[model samples]
Target: MSESKSYTGGCACGAVTYRIDGDPMAVRQCWCRHCQKLSTGGPTHNAFFMADAIAVDGTLASNAHAADSGNELSWYFCASCGTQLFGASSARPQMRAVRLGSLDQAHELQPTAAIWVQEAPGWVRIDPAMEQHPAQPPAPPPQNQS
Candidate 1:
């Protein structure tokens, strides 16, 4: 995707900024506990982005953690300000998890799926139309490796 249709976002303090181009691959809610704590400090919520569709700038802070699956998940946030921007798994090296709330037009992006639904709290109600998976789905088969 070229830089034609741009989406601008920044941290709460404006210390970090970035832009994304093109439509995202999947906009969905995650019931993963990690997402709950990261997004709202509560139950998980919907966020959207395509792993390969975003081109971002501005050096954001990052924290790497060993997820429940034992893979390292790197979370990117504002270095100057603690604003979580995105996350990624080394296992799924090709994609990114962008914070939909940071989008310039967040209302336009609605969730399509809900992963890790078995962990979803009782209070968090989601659309029944969404396809709910109980846990992190199997990673896509590797296409490039030496």
Candidate 2:
């Protein structure tokens, strides 16, 4: 839809290089507590993308945590500098939540939505135009039927 969109990113050390073929999902700033704590900046903002749409090279270290959905989310970070790069959830195996800061054009991405706003600090404000979901989006319709 966006002129065959494409994007690229990598780890802090640049050992790992990655690419995305399509437009990102929700380019938003997440003010959730976990995000605030884990993020180097004031809060954790990211440009989410479909896992299937991403092509990554190199390696990364991950830490799994229980997400609000009661599923374990694998947070992939650079083993070298501990820079969080992306996240993948077991519940939605088809999506990869890439940290916006890790992208080559991070500033170009503007958040279109907000999630977990309740946890957002008072200092942060979000646009009302974006859709706000209490938690991760519902799973897309099952592609195959048993």
Backbone-clash count (model 1): 2
- Residue pair clashes in candidate 2: 27-111
**Over 4 Å off, model 2:** 1-3, 106-108, 127-146
**Residue 126 lDDT, candidate 1, scale 0-100:** 73
lDDT of each: 0.70, 0.75
- RMSD, each candidate, Å? 3.9, 3.4
Off by over 4 Å in 1: 1-5, 43-53, 138-146
lDDT digits (tens) for residues 25-55 of candidate 1: 5666777878877876453443444555666
Top lDDT model: 2
Q: Which 10 residues in a row give candidate 1 its minimum summed lDDT? A: 137-146
